[model samples]
Target: MRIRLARPEDSAALLRIYAQYIHSPVTFEYALPTEPEFAARIGRISETYPYLVCEENGGISGYAYAHRQAEREAYQWNAELSVYLDAAAASRGRGTRLYRMLLDILPLQGVRSAYALVTLPNAASERLHASLGFRTMGVQSEAGFKAGAWHDVAWFVKDIAPHDAAPRPLLPVSRLDADVLRRILDTRG
Candidate 1:
């Protein structure tokens, strides 16, 4: 598997993987975004945070990204995390590999806390988050209505790095040094 920064051109392949969850109660999304819309989102988020993909034999197998947790300035150091994998790629340790690189890269961009929300009853997702040190904060009971039923969301949080009194200005992913970024991708532990 190859892990690298996501590009706008990956929108289509990424969308295909994401579509797997759209119809299920695992995700609240009821409709798939248009290709252009997904492309725009990829371009916008990678500007300041890590948006990465794992490719197997030239095909996108899975992807993970961090987006603003909230609009308030105080939440700048915190981000919401999400990941999706191709059906064939599930349970093969690819998600772990993608997340390891993602979590490693975030600290360099000044991320202090990372959050994830898993729709209730997803044992695999919850297990993955737990393996990565994410602690359950709480659960939103029936927080969203989807697929003819209300679903709950379990929130988990992980500290990416030390939260100091004063944080250095966030470094955009584009400005990250190539060698440093390479080391992150090559990290196995």
Candidate 2:
């Protein structure tokens, strides 16, 4: 199997893997809205980096990607990421491989920190992230309402790089020199 960057053409396969979570009994009962505006969202986020997949036998079996942590300038360099594998593709190491590739790329992209919030206590995911050096940031006690009840969320985090790395500039950001801004904005390049 090989790990590679996801292309715009890969969105359909990415969505397929994502849909499994959206439909799973564990996930759906306390269902959260996914990309309701996929078109607009895809148009924007597909332009970023660390959006990747693991492919084998000529098909994508798993995927991982990062996006803006929030809309605030202070959140730059801190990304929110997700990773998923096709249930049929589990136990074959696709999820671990995909996440490794993403973590390897994130710091190079100036990502100082990365975070994940999981509704269920996924031992595999927790183990995988822990292997990649993430730590238990904290959990939100009974923080989410899914299906018909309350659920807890665990937030895991990793410092991808030293805090000494310069902060990413603000949007409409004059903070970065033109060259620096060019690199961050042109992730796919």
Candidate 3:
């Protein structure tokens, strides 16, 4: 298996993996985005954040990414992470590998804190986050309504970098040194 930076062209395969969670409480998205829409999302997100995909046997097995946790300027140092795997890839450690890489890369982008929201009853996702050193902050009961019922979401957080009194401005993923970025992606756990 290999983890690499995602390109817009990989959207179709990534979208296929993401669609699996649309109907389930694993994700809050209620609709499957079109290939073009997903491709555009890749382009927009890659501009400032790390967008990664894990491929195995010449196919994308899973994917993970981090985005701004909130819009305000003070929240720039915080990011929210998401990961999705094809049904066949579950329980195979692909999600862990993908998240590990993402956690490694985020600090380089000036991200100090990484967060994740796991919908209730997803034991696998909860285990994954906990295993990665993320502590549960709290749960928002009935945070979302989907699939004919209400779902609760648990918030998990981990400090990826030290919180300094004065932090240097965030560096976009695009500005990271090419060699360093490549090395991070090539390094496997």
Candidate 4:
């Protein structure tokens, strides 16, 4: 399996894999995309956020991405991460390969830390992040509701790099910045 930057052509497969997370067992309530919206988002997101996917035998098997953890400029240095692996791809090492690639590359692009909010009691998801160096950021029981069920959300975080002790002003050089990523994606077309 190979982990690489996601391409425009790979969006369909990426969407399919993410949609799997909304099904039973996971029971996530987010609505899956309609065909038209799916195409538009793939074209939109793959450019800026450093979205990535894992492929084996020429088919995408897993995907991940990073986005602003908060909207304010003061929160610029931190980002949230999302990783979803196709069930068929899990336990076969695909998720690990893909996430490692993302973690390694994103920090250099200006990401200081990446946070993940997983539904509570999700050992598999929690363990995956822990093994990757993420520490628990605690859990909020019944923080969200989906499909008429209350779900606990666990927050896990990992710092990508060691920053200087000085509290520096947010700048492009301090980290590539999400805005920079936004610009990069715009250039992909």
TM-score of each: 0.96, 0.77, 0.98, 0.79
Where does candidate 3 clash, by residue pair? none
lDDT of each: 0.89, 0.67, 0.93, 0.69
lDDT of 1 by residue, 1-189 (tens): 778889999999999999998899877878999999999999999998888899888899999998988998888888888889999999999888878887888888898999999999899999999999999999999999998888899999999999899897767778888899988886742
- Tens digits of per-residue lDDT, candidate 4, 96-156, equal 6656766665665556788888887777888889899999989888888786778888889
Top candidate (lDDT): 3
Residue 80 shift from truth in candidate 4, angstroms: 1.1
Clashing pairs in 2: 29-146, 29-147, 30-146, 30-147
Q: Rank the candidates by TM-score, best first.
A: 3, 1, 4, 2
Once fitted onto the true fold, the runs of candidate 1 whose alpha carbons sit more than 4 angstroms away are none
Worst 10 residues of 1 by lDDT: 180-189
Model 2 lDDT per residue over 70-113, tens place: 77777777888887898888866676666655555667667778
Candidate 1, residue 176: how far the Cα is off, in Å: 1.7
Highest TM-score: give the candidate number.
3
Each prediction's RMSD to truth: 1.3, 5.5, 0.9, 5.7
Error of 1 at 24 (Å): 0.9
- The number of clashing residue pairs in each candidate reads 0, 4, 0, 4
Mind sharing the TM-score for model 2? Answer: 0.77
1-189, model 3: which lDDT tens digit per residue?
889999999999999999889998888888999999999999999999999999899999999999989999999999999999999999999999999999989999999999999999899999999999999999999999999899999999999999999898888999999898889888863
